[model samples]
Target chain A: MKFTILINEGPYQHQAADSAYQFAKAALEKGHEIFRVFFYNDAVNNATRLAIPPQDDRNITVQWAELAEQNNLDMVVCIAAAQRRGMLDDDERDRQGKDASNIHPAFRISGLGQLVEGGIQSDRLITFGD
Target chain B: MAMLHIVNKSVFERGTLDSCLKSSLSGSSILFIEDAVVSAVNNTAVSDKIKAELSSKNFYVLTPDLNARGFTDADLIEGIKGVDYAGFVDLVADNSNVQSWL
Candidate 1:
């Protein structure tokens, strides 16, 4: 089965991100395809590379980046949400004349239409939120 | 395919329920869970909106959540069904996707 995962909360602040990551990992391990992982609301924070956690804590952003790298996952951060939360890729930063871009390379900024497309293309769309 | 939309916050507290209603496709199912159970009550400010949607969408309130919040079936708006956890699972299985408005 092809599944699309939606995450609606920022990392560490809520368990939604962790649960979504675990579900995505389990689905991949079970030999199921993950069509896309759509980050919306505060979840767009997960795609930022500037987040730094203490040495004792798990780095959620790194985990997602590594998972995406290993699986060649299509991890998308909603552009509207990302912009609102100050998460920007190089193109967005350049377009908006921002001084810096914090978005990790593993994730791409896209429109909400990608989320609608995920629902249309995937067999199941599972949402994890606050 | 139809979607199962879950609203976990009170309509009085947030616009999650309204957004869920607006985003829901025709023939989708809406389930009120957690604090959202408050919206199932009769005569609330949003009751008219809920009643209006009933003609096109299926409405359900989690029985445990309703009870936890000190509400009962009699407190619910007409056409709203109170369901158990098992029913929640069944609704998820019956729908093609799950969209939680948090």
Candidate 2:
């Protein structure tokens, strides 16, 4: 099976991101393919590289980055959402003349078309939010 | 086609569960996670609403979330099965699509 994940809430503050990550990992471990992980709404915050969680707490951003690297996952952050929430990649930072880019390298900024494509191409589009 | 309708809000706190149940087809599955697990508890104010839908929709609750909220299987309404994180993955795989009520 191929699954596309849609996350709508940020890390730590909500369980949506954590649940989505756990679901994705479980699916991959079961030999299912993760077609993509699309971050929308406050979920775009999950792509920020500046979050420094407590030492004993799980670093949600790092967890996502490691997972993406290990599984070669396609993690997308909606450009519209990212911009609204002040999340910036290198290109966006340069284009907008921002001083810094905070988006984690594991995620790419894209349009909503990526989300649509995931829904169309994947066997199941599972959303974790709120 | 059978779909999975995931509700993650408390019934007392939000009307998301009601909306999800209203929109879900008869054969679809409804899985309660996070704060929504409270809806799966037996003898609650909204338990009747959930019970009424059991004949038409399959009900499920995430065990971890339930436990975290101080609930156990014994407290869950009859006919609502419990699933862990891995079981959540299985539900997604088993269903044709997922509609999360946020």
Candidate 3:
């Protein structure tokens, strides 16, 4: 079974981000293919390199990065959501002439079409968020 | 025909989830998002067979929903599966019909 994650809650806000992490790791253990991980709405915050979680709590930004590294999953941030949240990629950063690009590797800005596709290509499509 | 069934409510609030999926006609995707993912792992009022039929039709359950709820794929209810945004796009691309069940 191929797996895909649609995270709607931002990483810092709540359990949505962490829950996605646990599921991704489990899918791999089950021998299921992790096709992609999509962050939408506020959940796109997980892809932003600028997030700074308190040292007391979990480092969700880094956690997501580690999850991507372990699973080799495609972490996608909805372009619309990212822009709304002001998470600009290198190209967008350059175009906007921003000083730095905070987006991490293994994550890219994409469109909602990816959500529709996740439903079609896989044997099943699972979604997470509030 | 397929529907992207989104249980976006924070928690499994009574009949909201059942209402969400039941309200949707057949051949639709039921995504338990946010706190909705708990619906997939919890003991559902609906029968397992019915849920299985839903998945057999290729109805999808997005994975991140489960994760957000602190669940992993192994903890998912029987017959429920996961799909990311890319795969989600493929779902809409493959199927010509999509009605969002909120």
Quote each prediction's TM-score. Answer: 0.62, 0.95, 0.61
Task: Compare candidates 1 and 3 on DockQ and give the better one.
Answer: 1
Instruction: Look at candidate 2 and tell me the lDDT of residue B39.
Output: 88
Cα lDDT listed for each candidate: 0.88, 0.93, 0.67
Error of 2 at A16 (Å): 1.2
DockQ of each: 0.20, 0.82, 0.10
Q: Lowest-lDDT window of 10 residues in candidate 2 chain A?
A: A21-30
lDDT of 2 by residue, B18-100 (tens): 89988989999999999999989999888898899999999999998999999998899999999988899999888877888
Q: Model 2, stretches more than 4 Å misplaced?
A: none
User: Which regions in candidate 1 have their CA more than 4 angstroms from the true location?
Assistant: B1-96, B99-101
lDDT winner, 1 or 2 = 2
Best by DockQ: 2
Taking the tens digit of each residue's C-alpha lDDT, what string does model 3 give over A13-55? 6766775676677667656787888888888778777767688
- What value does the lDDT take at residue B71 in candidate 2? 90
Highest TM-score among the candidates is held by which one? 2
